[model samples]
Target: MTPNDPIDKGDLLNVIKWAIIGIVAIAIVLAAMAGFGQLNVNNVITLLTILAIALPIYYFVMMLRSSKVTKVERSRVKAYIPLFFAAAIFWGIEESGSVVLALFAEQRTVLHIGSWHFAAANFQSLNPLFIMILTPVFVWLWEHWKKQPSAPGKFSAGLVFAGLSYMWMALPGMLFGTSGRVSPFWLVGSWFIVEIAEMLISPIGLSITTKLAPNAFRSQMMSMWFMADATGQAINAQIVKFYSTDTEVQYFLAIGLVSVVFGIIMFILVKKINTLMEGIH
Candidate 1:
């Protein structure tokens, strides 16, 4: 491949830098949480503040090193903005699904297999653990698969996987009912499934955004990519009210079905979307 044919070396470096930043930041945050043996408002607040400051500085440095883009490239970027927009909502749903699990997981109050009692944010912390275990598995599968999926196909499948994760919870809710404590494995399974969806969405979403992005707005497009996360979560805040013990099954089914349907739609339209993308995948 030529220097700019597959991907520009500089942009690839920027992606590598941010990917490292994210991984290292998650590791540090999880390490800090582990040191305290749990999460609390104080540590979370502090870490989040540090992250907010640190991420922008990193982005700023990269932006300073970036060159300007062309007019044709700018026009191409505008058309691709919708890709990021859709990704954001799907990302939001994925996030909101975790919050739902955390809400119910805390309610159980005890895990008989261990001495540990349920704590606020305790279930939420399992995300990093699962990510560690499952990431390489996902990477191997994606890399070794007979055929590769386009960006739209992967993104759409991610949404469906997220929906499937919610549906995974609905099974226990339907079978065991929500009256009292059930099993920890239910939450475990849901987290595992969703993180698979993350493997599909998060990194790929970043890559697609940059590849499809206009030259002038390369870095800006990356920034906009995260907006999908915020947008999905914000929507989550509003709709999450619908999730509770009594409504748990319904909520899971609703989100799950919606995600699956959209995934199908995107799959059907993947060819059209790919055409619009020109060469980005």
Candidate 2:
């Protein structure tokens, strides 16, 4: 904002006001979805309710407190949005695919690792478990690299890995026809690929905001980082509405193709995007 364009107190208040309105609107839509049998889980509603309350409160405060943007900084901030958005979309689809994976997982069986066995009910933690084990090794590998992808390139690579994760699942869904449970190893394999993608994306995500964000809009850009993920998950919610046992195979194939296609495009265009970023990597 220019010096002449003073921050109106009412305008600032209005931002918070509209934030509440948007949250309430989403809450209503979620409530309606739950009412209509689209979503019926207490845990999901509780998470949404907490997000409805907490996210706006955090951002409203940030909006009030953040400094004004300069024209150059504004341009930089604009450049990062698409990059963050691309990474966020990867997160959305890959993570959302987990829910679909579970829809096909064996409910009555157990999964084995080494000497240990786990019931299907505990399979949800597999991703995090993979993440915890792999992170240090990945971090070490990253540290040893002489040349690295630009921030945009790293994000693109993550997208490709994410797409590959779904493609792996698509193979089984295609072969198994969703009529009976596939081996738990399919779930294990899919989770393994995603956790690898997360390792690539998550570290880059944590760093790029600081590297790329405008001084005036640092916090706001970070907020955008989060919003990108939220937007992707919102898309996932809609996608989930169409998924079922019968459609599982095709669902994985379609999304996998979309992600991989976009990822290839992103990989091809990474240098151009990085050039547009003006050395933010």
Give lDDT per model, in order: 0.71, 0.70
lDDT of 2 by residue, 1-281 (tens): 45334448997899899989988988987798778888767547556645644664465445444566555555555557557667666877766745766665654123666688766657788887998999899888878987977777777777777888888877765775656555677778888887887887777786887776666556666776777677567667667767777777677778877777777888898877776667667
lDDT of 1 by residue, 101-181 (tens): 667777742455577565647677777887898888878987898688988788788878887887887898788787888
Cα error of candidate 1 at position 259, Å: 1.0
Off by over 4 Å in 2: 1-11, 14-67, 107-117
State the TM-score for model 2. 0.76
Off by over 4 Å in 1: 1-82, 108-110, 114-120
- Provide the clash count, candidate 2: 0
lDDT agreement of model 2 with the native: 0.70
TM-score of each: 0.69, 0.76
